[model samples]
Target: SAVISQKPSRDICQRGTSLTIQCQVDSQVTMMFWYRQQPGQSLTLIATANQGSEATYESGFVIDKFPISRPNLTFSTLTVSNLSPEDSSIYLCSVAGSLSYEQYFGPGTRLTVT
Candidate 1:
């Protein structure tokens, strides 16, 4: 199992602001995933960031809006661009287990755009 941590457990930002969320893993991992969970909604994959390569964003997500960076095997970052009230959601950082497909998530950074 891998332990991941994220910054800013929660934040309230004004519209049009951007927030950069950090993710750190206790151990090296083969893959790291970023997800967004809207209020009362399921997790949505934003991108997959693996070491030695560029992050891959999902169909609906573009790199310009949600730039991602993976500096090493145990660290990654996700930045939300052009924030809006609709962007308010719980951003979670996750990594899958070595032998299991199950993923472990960070406590999450809850963002509220006001």
Candidate 2:
């Protein structure tokens, strides 16, 4: 199983600002993912960040808006750039466990835009 932890559990930011959140894993996992969960909703895939490759973002998302970096097998970071009121959400980092198909997620960084 994979254990993931993310930094900055919560933050209140102003408009036009940016925030970078870090994720750390206890084991060397193959794939790491970033997700966003809006208020009262399920998680949505933001991008897939492999250990040595560029992150593949989902449709409706762009690299300039959400830049991701996975420097090694067990560490990654996600930056939310050019923030706005709509950007307020719970950002999470997740990784699929070694055995099961289920993905384990970090506690998430709750951001509020003001």
Candidate 3:
């Protein structure tokens, strides 16, 4: 299994601004995913960052809006562009357990847009 870590556990941003969240894993994992959860909702996958290649974003999300970078197996970054009130949520970094098929999540970066 891999242990994931995220930076800037929380932040407050103004509308139209941007914030970047960083994720790090203890060991190389098969997959890494980025997710977001609203105040009272479940996690929504934002994208899959492939090492050395462009990221694959989910529907309703785009590269221009949520740019991601995976420099290597143990590190990745996600930038939230042009923030809005609706963007306020808990952003998480996750890794798929190699053999257990379990998923481990970072504490999360809670953003409050105003």
Top lDDT model: 2
TM-score of each: 0.96, 0.96, 0.95
**Clashes within 3 Å, all models in order:** 0, 0, 0
Local distance difference test, each candidate: 0.92, 0.93, 0.92
Give the lowest summed-lDDT range of ten residues in model 2.
94-103
Q: Roughly what TM-score does model 3 have, to 2 decimal places?
A: 0.95
Model 1 agreement with the true structure over 19-113: per-residue lDDT tens digits: 99999999988789999999999999999998889999999999988999999989999999999999999999999888658888998999999
Model 3: residues >4 Å from true position, as ranges? none
Writing each residue's lDDT as its tens digit, candidate 3 over 1-106 gives 5777899999999999999999999898757899999999999999988798889999999999999989898999999999999999999999888665678999
| Local lDDT at 11 for model 1 | 95
RMSD of 2: 1.0
Clashing pairs in 1: none
Clashing pairs in 3: none
- Score residue 100 of candidate 2 by CA lDDT: 51
User: What lDDT would candidate 1 get against the real structure?
Assistant: 0.92
Taking all chains together, the TM-score of candidate 2 against the true structure is 0.96
